[model samples]
Target: MSFNPFSLAGRRILVTGASSGIGRQIAISCADMGAAVVITGRDPTRLDDTLGQLVGDGHTAVPADLLETGAIDRVVAASGALNGVVLAAGIAKMVPFRMISQAHLDTVLGLNVHVPLLLIKSLLAKRSLQQGASIVFVGAVASEVGPVATAVYSASKAALLGAARTLALEVAKHKMRANVLSPGYVRTPLLDALGNTGAKIDALLDITPLGMGEPVDVAHAAVFLLSDASRWVTRSLFIADGGLTTRMSV
Candidate 1:
């Protein structure tokens, strides 16, 4: 068989946070690329909405809270042996340093960092993954570039980037690639919530040079990383920010 590269026809992918936002887009895109996708989220209704838009066969919805570490095994088992996994399940909260509480910190870090680690631990069981399985963690540009009122959120995401780099090296021998996709402001429900106030929206747009990107922009980059196209790529961070990280504005 001539190696049919870029064809995920026989691949099985698991996408978390697929109820909405960038996760939803990734699930739909994966299915469109011919992969059987298992999407997980806490909201059954939104998950169903995402599943309704998939383009391939064998797409399933497994609703579960990613923060529940003990349930990861069951979730992975339910998804079957997977060819790819997208850790897009995360949370972000804006709070000043003085206003930050342990509970708040734990909530964000638990989902953004701890849950992803646990999920990978469950997926890395012997014979649990295909030979070329790829893993993508949906980190934020804030991982490298900090923003105001994002101390806790940024710290959690930064840990994800750090973990991805180290884990990539450890998993390289298994032919399993791991990388972080750091996106700038994307047109997602999360952004909508954050930018709801006019002043905040303007402040963000002014700094984003190219303005906010659409979810599809991030999804396209993810597809490349998850496919054989990035077979030799590992232990790296791909920033999809619209020059937001390059600016010298202080």
Candidate 2:
């Protein structure tokens, strides 16, 4: 019995933030599942590195600053029609309430919220989305669980969840699906930037009963959401945080 429900053969997927971390993993995973993927990031070198790692044919690298909202339409035009999109590009910053400024809010929200929303609008406007298209937004457990000095980041993520829900409803008539993949502390460059502040790492681990998650852990979930296997699964938030949110009080 050959089970091929997860096969993405003939599908064209565009993955943002594909240069590194979870986005990189998702691009590789999607390619492995037989999708022709377009990997996008600001770093051309890193995007090329990811493109090289893709397992199958038709994978391409597209370097674009997603922060440039106007460029989103060009990105869609370059990639052609998209069957799926993984909006994985984002930034995380830790700033206390007193230290938070308009710049901080704009940077965080621009990347996390504004970019994804505008990208979707551009993609839809191009009429490039095929029926049954899936759009997966990478969210964070921080949206629901509180962490010190992550108010801005958390708010941005929370906004994604809300936006995805509404977008799901609006796009359903077009036979397109939208959802959020929220992950906990996965081993990524963002986490590495946090550094080992003595007990901070240990404290986080203690709260997460299943320990730290790897990039592939979230990547696999992304694959499921992108593939036809999850055709009925839209307007939902799939939490892949290894039970971290369940253990935490926030």
Candidate 3:
């Protein structure tokens, strides 16, 4: 008998956006901690790549486009009863307030807020979740800070913060936990795709006292929320931002 409170052994967990970046790292980390993980992403090839990199067996890849019709049911059907659910499938498009359009708002909010919350509803309908199961919504520091050209992205993430808090109260009677994870300037593939260079990088580094973070940093925090170590925790917003929000004003 050992005292590893963060061990995820004997648990079955599902993680969305597992093809790359933070989602991929979370899936791998969960398997490393001894959990059977079910990974889902829009791209089959990339999802398989992530599945192969997992540290343990019983980790399955279920490629899915959550925005597509009936996709939620298919994902739920493909996954088994779970101890944890990580909703990390989201997109961030930085658009200025003046240029924000309905389509842009719909696209960002649909995946970031709608898809994950809808999937949770489907999981509940099918009773696929285990008692004391934990549900984590991947949010961002944009929810609290005002970043230029990030109006839509900020709204999407802010919605998750409120959703998780309310979801915790609604699901508590079933002994399930709901929480949100907010990361600031994590160096992921997505960040790279957003063109992380020059002024943008320098600006982020200047605000983040500890500089930018990596996927592993956020993954470890996810492990804690998904593990029994945080059984008593729910409805809280856990921020892993390298002190980005701790800057002092002169």
Candidate 4:
């Protein structure tokens, strides 16, 4: 058989937030690429649904809220040693800067920032992460464009870029790589739930060049990064917003 650089055969991966949206798609994609995936989400029923959709066996599902004490340890234990991990577990709240409350701030930041960092730390201390492991953090274009009413959500995602880049360098000695995947307005239930109707929801003056994308679109980029195809790539932002960033950056 010809060696496929993109193949994830025999690899083990852990995907957080696998209950729905992009995270669930990543887990499914990993399995389709031949990876043994460990999926976790706060919702047990939805997580089980995601596990059932996986293409292969050796997949495990563990439901736990990241905010609870010892939650990271439990998740790390369930994942075992992993070749790749996707930190897609996050929550977004669209509150205006003046309207932001301490409660909302903590909730969003705790999930989006605190949990991912703590989870990575646990994976390291427990040695659950294999050498050359790829760590992908699910970020957002909101960080770049600063969408209105997304003060906290934007800040939370913005934190991942700096952290993931530094993490890439710190883990380089072990051949480990870290990168952030930023997606624009993806048409998921979460997307529909956010803003409902407003330009602020999209943060784009003009229509998105290719319009909104599907979960599989981001999953394809994530699969490439998780596989050996992105071995030479690290500390980069992989934007899968259908040219939204390209136009905005220019």
Instruction: Find the candidate with the highest lDDT and give its number.
Output: 4
Error of 1 at 19 (Å): 0.3
10 residues in a row with least lDDT, candidate 2: 194-203
Per-residue lDDT tens digits for candidate 4, residues 17-64, read 999999999999999999999999999999999989999789999999
Tens digit of lDDT per residue, candidate 1, span 1-250? 6875666788999999999999999999898888999999989999999999999689999989877655686688788888999999988777878899999988998889888888888788646677778999999987677777788988988888789888888888879999999998888888876655332656766788788898898988888889988898887889887878878345
Clashing pairs in 1: none
lDDT (0 to 1) per candidate: 0.86, 0.89, 0.90, 0.91
1-250 per-residue lDDT for model 2 (tens digits): 5878788888999999999999999999999989999989989998899999999898888899988755786688888888999999999888887899999999999999999999899888888888889999999998998678889999999999889999999999988999999998888987887654221655777778789999999999999999989999998999998887886755
Candidate RMSDs in order? 2.1, 1.6, 1.6, 1.5
Q: Give the alpha carbon lDDT tens digit for every residue of 188-212 in model 3.
A: 8788766543227567778788898
List residue ranges in candidate 4 displaced over 4 A: 197-206
- lDDT measured at residue 187 in model 2 versus the true structure, 0 to 100: 89
Error of 3 at 35 (Å): 0.5
